[model samples]
Target: MKTQNQFQLFKERRFLPYFFVQFFGALNDNIFKNALLTLIAFGAFNQETRELLTNLGALLFILPFFLFSALAGQLADKYKKAHIIRYIKFVEILIMGCATIAFWHHQLALLFVILFFMGSHSAFFAPVKYSILPQYLERDELVGGNGLVEMGTFVAILLGTILGILLIRIHTSTLFISIAIMLTAVLGFMTSLWIPNQKTISNPDLKINWEPFSQTWYVLKRAASQRTIFLTILGISWFWFFGSVIITQLYNYNQDILHGNEAVMILMISILSIGIGLGSLSCEKLSRHKVEIGLVPFGSIGLTLITIDLSFAHGLYPEQVINVSTFLSHWEGWHILIDLFFFGIFGGLYSVPLYVLLQSRTEEKERSQMIAANSVLNALFMVVASLFSIALLTLGLSIPQLFLVIGFCNLAVTMYLYKLLPEFLMRFIAWLLINCIYRVKITGIENIPEEGPAIITCNHVSLVDPIVVMASCHRPIRFVMDHQIFKIPLLKFVFQTAGCIPVASEKENPEIKERAFALVKEALDRGELIGLFPEGSLTSNGNIQQFRKGLERILNNNPVPVVPMAVQGLWGSFFSRRYGKAMLHWPRQFLFSKIGLQITKPIPPEEFNLEELKNITQNLRGDWE
Candidate 1:
């Protein structure tokens, strides 16, 4: 059993510096923006000028991505990312210095220009920020790495925004705010110096395109070549869009429908931020470190339902105006708070998997570019969301109504995407079943190799075997499944998203057999683990089948270690032969069933003989046969 302390992940150099850099960046961004927005909101500027300034501030922030994102992607691919990030931080310090001056002089135009420069810095940093994760961490750590980043970013945002608002009351705190922002930038720059230099993967011979918008489309089109990757990016963009809309609306909703003040607004933001932080942390526990995206759909559903409930809870606007203190006395405010919390929880679920997917699937050379593209899309979506909000308001929709409409739209869009790719939903179901119904106890799991290419040969006794391995294995495994099983109603989607490899005998599908062999070789070359069941199909009579030749091909070509494993006491379960069909009946005490996985010590590739390996695996199964 891994103890709670064992999960403290920040000790690794690959993660720590990046974590702090991101943390401080988020902190500085929100602090400056919120302080500026708060000043505008509280009538520091005349009401007529405040709205224009606020609108201009938002436009300046988003415009950089539209103009510079492609160049940012090119730069990230052309140079060492750590160096790029370091320079970006230096730029941030300069921009913050400018912001401090603006704050001192009370120059709104100057502050807005500084905000645009900050956005420019962020546009360039965005790609390197996400693209660096896969370069440093192992595949299994991707989920945890992303979770920490997400949690840290949001926590920083929460603190920055809250502090910005609170500091405004001090009246003489401008110098302190300026100093803090500059220090944050300096600290982030120092941390960037520690980021290991990552090699660029794009074609150096490629010419740079001058036209930004056209180049952006070209980059996006390239990403579109991979259907799953494209959809994943779209999903990520939508999440940002949805988040910006709800958060912006929550501000107005709290002020109007909930009749709350700035403190209540901050409370709403804090709850949502904390909820996401908690949800992001939960992924490590729920997924056991694998990038299980099934949670995305589950989170999306909760976000949709809770958002609608918040809308319904809004009720008719009260004729009597209420202050923040009085609003806290009402039940409706509490309900809205609850809804925001869940919305954030689901938001975390929705975003983390998309990050993992991008890291795992995108090509190394193009990774930063892909991430840059995602950032651009996110910015674009935010712009669209802003427009949507303004349009809805013009249509005489209240903030609460706008929330309901967008929330419903979010649900509709999510459903459409999930229907197109059922794997997202299917993986969620499989993940839920494993987490809820089974408390898997893995024995000899340490016997699995810690590094390098390896084959995990196990018996195929149940439909859930791959998922079980996925849940328990400390490293990522590309399992070879029977070709037909890949077509199983919802199982196909789960398998696809999980990146399972489908295989068949030469007698079954010669082309697929060759393709599977090539994929195994490729994965091995990349030092990834590939799992295969030597028993070509699930046991028909609750006994091991003859070992097949595919294992020999994998071992001979890859020349990697082999770890033999056995799944005990699963042959008669719902998915096994005793049930006669997959999940035909639920066992009365299903949750109590003691399924076991025993892993044998790794056999070096040089010592691995086909017949000998089969015997070793057979022995591990013991009396289960």
Candidate 2:
């Protein structure tokens, strides 16, 4: 459960074999892909031929996801995922063997056929690769597991791409590359043999639908069953769109604009890969081993900023840098390298959380189907990116302009996503507050049940009490709070996204108070966690306020269990009322100041009372204040 170093998963039979299977598969695909692309773009100068080969190659590889993913999802769900993976790897070996023959015979058309089949091989493997993790890994391990997988994926990509570029330029290079891919495929199949098979079938009684179009629609609809899941899917597809655009254009961006050769392109890509590896590794630590979607916006902002900088960073080195050393000799080259590096870093940050969220939220029986839908969407978006890139370039837009345009488009997309579901923004804020401003020690977090309706009673000590409590729980809580809290500029956005119920004193606004209770009832009926400060308001002084009787009102209607919580060590801080007013007086509590959230086991309705709840809160706070 520690999962501090994702590399430890390599020792796990559940994870290690599958890791290699995916790694080798990715490596094999990229090596062949980059080699063919290098041959098409750089091996010849035929304009029409280059355009045709490049477009055809991209289309051929991505088309399978559109056509066969539904079938892949069905097979993965209906049978043993491990068996499907093994069979896919076996197919990969055959595909790579054919690749070798085509390379040997200089059969261009045959190579494309092999590429399509390779795509088919991956299309089948992807659903099983993703969906099996939840079965193999614990909830806490999901983020780290995904981090390792993503890191391995990009690392494989880095090695494959660099190898593809270097090997193709050598004497009898295709011979070497062809042999390498075939051997990789064999290694993939062999490692996949060791992946432990699960006895449980996700859907044994389900019937397979061979129809691609309608089944594709069925899977997509299923994946989008929840609003958050669908939006996450959209966010994921957008990432693919961004990635494909950058990769598809990197060759042209290097040549036409930077006047660089293959070495420069390889160097740029390598930095990006390294950045992604580091970023992916950091997710577990930054998110504290949780599926923190907060990192999504952070990653998106970094991505947009880095890309926009890339547009301006270029044109510094007008002349060609013959080699990597020469490219590094100029600061301008370093700028481009840095831009691409952060691109990878933010990309990893953006994507890892979404995968974790998607996997963790989905139902077991339909997990593979959901992932298949995500894959379909990703493929569609990537195909659109390919076409969009071509159209823009053909329209005489410089690569720099293209980057600028994409960056802005990303900004727009994120804004829309955040608006659609404010949780993304709220989580980002809570994550920042917990990780950056306070060193929080969360105890009794498990007391908050993972499911069912519950009322959380806490002794509020500061304006950020809800935030501290919110950050501690695995599930989202709809906190009942003073409506005036929304009047605060910064806290307003956070509270709004968190779906905090804004209540008022009955004398001040009776209708608002009525509506607040109505919303609370609705949320509890939906099996959500509702957090409210039993003291009714933040302590005007440093002492805990008297518990009001409103707690009984909530319990009367709901009869749900109560989770007693306490927030401590926040008095006199900026958000606490100890310093005259919250946020008005910024006195004390430097970065990472000690803060603690303590929760008691859920008190059943039979045993719950105001006196006992307050006593539990006091004990949890434990003389801290």
Candidate 3:
């Protein structure tokens, strides 16, 4: 039986310890960094030195990624990750000690050094943090796991940033702040102790390469070989770029443009953070905990459109520059806030799947290296975004204009990527159609094998039948379809990319029929679920046709369990026979159609009598005839 409860995911020891460790790590990092930034802005450095110090601080933080990430990736692959994390936390304590001295002496140089050390700690920790996810999770749990991690990280950042600023303003002793950081590090270290020893998957006998840049590049190239993984990495990097640009610009927008106080800054960040948290949680609900990455493009489109809306809402230099409170008092501010929230929501939708894809698809031995490569990409993109922001400001563009540019750029990048990989766009279209237009309720999904090969037998009722099943199935499926349908102008690209098998009737094209069966057999042999409509063709009438014999041949040869399934409530729709001449029909309601899927228990080959299975499927289908 499958469960959807969030707490149920933590019952396994493999995830909980790591979860706490990561959560606290994020919390502490944000707390200290925000505190340091506040000190610099307020009094730690004079205005003349503040800009240089702040930029240097940013450089020092990202520098470790460029300098130590390859070595970090190597270490994560060389030893047990639990031990490494423990040692890293201990180093964090020592770094905090340095922070205490810096605060006491009011030494800017010492503070910068501590910040660099903190970044170095994060650099070393990055590879292990992400790479260990796959080892602890089942493939099905990957999405949920990644969602939780993302949610936790963002929540921690939000809270820590808020508290860090708030706490420093209380006029508390500097020693107290130092103590808080130390205790947080200790707690994180203790949590690390609870993580079970995960052995190194890659025991590279070769000595570590010290040339970090070249070594990191080589690792990235290796990760780029897998098409899906490579695309996912790009997707993740794009997310960081998008997010960093928005959050960084938001500070200036709030302070200078909106004339808002620190409270307003907190509010904007809080809304974005909460939206991401909700969106991350929504992935489990929307996908039913399966890693359905097709949602990525949908998220990207939403994000881009909302950002543009936000830009327009601000308008090009309004006559009155409203303060934060006054802006909120007006309808326009509320509109912008709503837009920002949804932006975060869609942002959440975009990121969760990429994390799952990386975790589930990468080779275990090099998982850490791959994650390090991902971190490197994230750092690189962030740097580029920073540079872009600086350049845009230098070009005399206002903050709002920069926002507009980034948002439009987001649309361009997403479109180009989707054009290159039509599967993403197709899946997005299918997923949106199913979720928004049809209320897809499913039963007996468990009958579909959790792992390994199985044959899915269904009634073919429409041209889009395969897509309906694809959208609902928990796992990926290769569908056998009519060759002519596969050749439809724009759709041929999608069908081919999805690797759907195209077949002609034996009487029509014997060679195509033979090739189709061969592909089906090969897919099943590789433990992939293959879907075939036993009717051999869509019914011209709104009823299930007589069962075909191909399903029998498949089961006899492979001897795997057979899952019988059906789709109800689609017959009267435009895609069905009820529409005039089928393919000529247009979409019925823009956003309200009824659809349902039901599955019967898997019948072993020995128990699979074709007539019996057909009758059982008919009964389960409940008179779709």
TM-score (all chains, Cα) for each model: 0.83, 0.95, 0.90
Per-residue C-alpha lDDT of model 2 across residues 162-192, encoded as one tens digit per residue? 8888787777987898888988989999998
lDDT (0 to 1) per candidate? 0.79, 0.86, 0.79
RMSD of each: 4.6, 2.1, 3.2
Lowest summed-lDDT stretch of 10 residues in model 2?
A: 43-52
Candidate 3 residues 1-625, lDDT tens each?
A: 2235555778778888898899988888888877776666545454335534444566677667767888898888877788889999888888888888887777767878888888899999999898887777766677778888888988988987787766665676476667778888889989999999865455556367778878988888887787777777888888888877787666556645665555666777788888988898788778877778788987998999998888766533344544557767867677778888999899999999878778777777777788888888888887777777777776788778888999999999988888766778778766876788778888877678888998888877777778888888867788888898889875676677678999998899999999998999999899999988888777787777788888888877799988889888777677677767765778664566667788988888898888887787677778754
Question: How would you order the candidates by TM-score, starting with the best?
Answer: 2, 3, 1
Q: Please tell me which predicted candidate would have the highest lDDT against the true structure.
A: 2
Better of 2 and 3 by lDDT: 2
Pairs that collide, model 3: none
Candidate 3 ranges beyond 4 A from true positions: 1-3, 10-13, 40-56, 170-173, 198-211, 313-324, 488-494, 552-560, 583-590, 605-608
TM-score result, candidate 3 = 0.90
Model 1 over residues 166-263: C-alpha lDDT tens digits? 77546786877787788888999999888766554454655677788987987888888888888899999999888887876664465456656678
Clashing pairs in 1: 201-365, 423-493
Question: Following a full C-alpha superposition, what root-mean-square deviation does model 1 have from the true structure?
Answer: 4.6
